[model samples]
Target: MSLEIRIAAPEDAFAACTVLRRSITECCVADHKDDPAILGAWLGNKTPQTVASWFESPTNYSLVALKDGAVIGVSLLTGAGKLALCYLLPEARGLGAGKAMLAKVEETACNWGVKAVQLHSTATGEEFFASQGYVRSGHVRSPYGVDTIFFWKQLDRGAAPDTSQRKRFCNCNSA
Candidate 1:
């Protein structure tokens, strides 16, 4: 199967949301521990409309990973260089889709001239993020009742776009 990663469109919200929910419910058992209260709160705002709004937000860059034209993974990066979300269908976890999406997120962060990228990783995702060069920074109890691991990666700003040449429209360092 071929995997493709691209900017997410509003129309992809449903499929992306599905992937997000499934990934959390199935793959994140270590984090939520099958606790209905934690899962419910964590997934409360993951609706299609919310996902569509995320795709449309000027401060966010959203991406979807497609496997043979089906959305199998989704990710979002903020202008401030936070990886707000990254999820993949359980069946798609071992594939390279997650890595591709992360590369794209880092590329976009560099384009925005971000110095670092941060994320709160679930228990299931800690090793994956660590393998991708993220350093564990701290730990926190999420509002949804899950214990989360914080990770950050300092980007190579040398490859970032020159701020002098482009109009600063985001809250990133370029601005």
Candidate 2:
């Protein structure tokens, strides 16, 4: 099915929570190993109420990807250039949805007067982040024991540098 990307509203919290929980449970099992404690801790704050809180935050920029009027994915960015969340259901993987969501996040960052974005990714998501121009900056063990890869990507503003009215500070020695 074709997908649509848009700013997330408060009403979308429940659907966004569903997508986030499923993506974590099914798509992240390889990293979390189905450990209830780990998964529970990782997903503890992903309830619909928290999702609504994200929408309510003035410093947050949240987006949701929809298919056939249902939320299939969610992306969230903090005003401070942090990519807080990006999740999609199992069926949505490998279909460019994640990349699209990330692009929108970058756009939001630039609009918010930022030069780059950063995120802490799960081990399973490391390759995907790298493929999208994000570089590995660090790694750490989460409280749940899952390995996390930190990433940062430069945002392109699509404007060529203008050197028409420039200053000349270099002096050339006579040959």
Candidate 3:
């Protein structure tokens, strides 16, 4: 089945949250404690109000993947590029939806002149992002109470200065 991709609107926040929450709970298991208390406080307890706040934030951007009129995946960008959240339903996995979502998020970041994009990734997703050009920054303990690897990618601006020039300039005596 084909999927339709679009920028998420305010009204779609709740549904988007559902997809995110589910994906995190199921797919992020290896990255977090399975204890109900921790899981509930972290992922299972997200409310529509929180999701709506994200949609209303000027610096945040969300994209949704729709198949058969249902939101199957979502990617949210925040901090003008400092952070990102992406999740996909199990049924939607391995269909290029994740890649497509990341592509759109990077495009959005480029439009906003963001220098890079970063995300805290689960062990499973670490490899996925690596395949998509993200490099592991380090591992961090999740604010929600778990540990995961962090990854980031510098966006290719297509017309930016080459690294050689920057390195040469950094050597002051090179003048």
Candidate 4:
């Protein structure tokens, strides 16, 4: 089935949290769970409230995907052009959803006049981000001893034709 992408609403907070937690547990910090406190801190000690607060922030934007009525994948990008969260349900992996979302993020960053974008990616996501043109900048260690790779991609400033072209490219899904 094809995936539908849209901005996440306030009501989608809890569902977003579930996907994030699952991503951390299954992909990012799976081995760190032996130390529960470390694990909690590693994932930012997140709860529904924390996730909701993130959604409410003006500095962040969420791109979410749904299959039927269930949320399947999501990517959160900060106003400063840092990618904050990206997770896909196990069933939703291996699809083009992640690539589409990454493209959406780049389009948004370009609109904001951001010179570049950065992210701390998990081991599993490293290859994907690299494939999307992000180059490793450094290595980051999570609170639970999880090592995250830092990557950054410079924006192709001259690529955006103008306001009209940008609007069209940014809203590619709407078209």
Best by TM-score: 1
Best by lDDT: 1
Task: Tell me the number of clashing residue pairs for each predicted model.
Answer: 0, 0, 0, 0
Clashing pairs in 4: none
Local accuracy of candidate 1 as per-residue lDDT tens digits, 1-175: 9889999999999999999899999999989999999999999999999999999999999999999999999999999999999999999988999999999999899889888999999989999999999999999888999999999998984565557777667777843
Would you estimate the TM-scores of all the predictions?
A: 0.89, 0.86, 0.85, 0.82
Evaluate all candidate structures by whole-model CA lDDT and list the values in order.
0.94, 0.89, 0.81, 0.80
Residue 87, model 2: Cα distance from true site in angstroms: 0.3
Candidate 3 lDDT by residue in tens digits, 64-167: 89988888988889855855678898778998889999998988888888888988887868889999999898999776777778888889657676576454
Clashing residue pairs in candidate 3 (N, C-alpha, C atoms within 3 angstroms): none
Runs of candidate 3 with Cα error greater than 4 angstroms are 157-175
Ten residues in sequence with the least summed lDDT for candidate 2: 166-175
Clashing pairs in 1: none
lDDT of 2: 0.89
Q: Which stretches of candidate 1 lie over 4 Å from their true place?
A: 157-175
Q: Model 3: which ten-residue window has the lowest total lDDT?
A: 161-170
lDDT of candidate 4 over 8-124, digit per residue (tens): 777888887787778767765544655777667766755778777787888998888787778877888999889988888777788787888888888898889888899988788
For model 2, residues 95-144, the per-residue Cα lDDT tens digits are 77788889888987988878779888998888999998899999978776
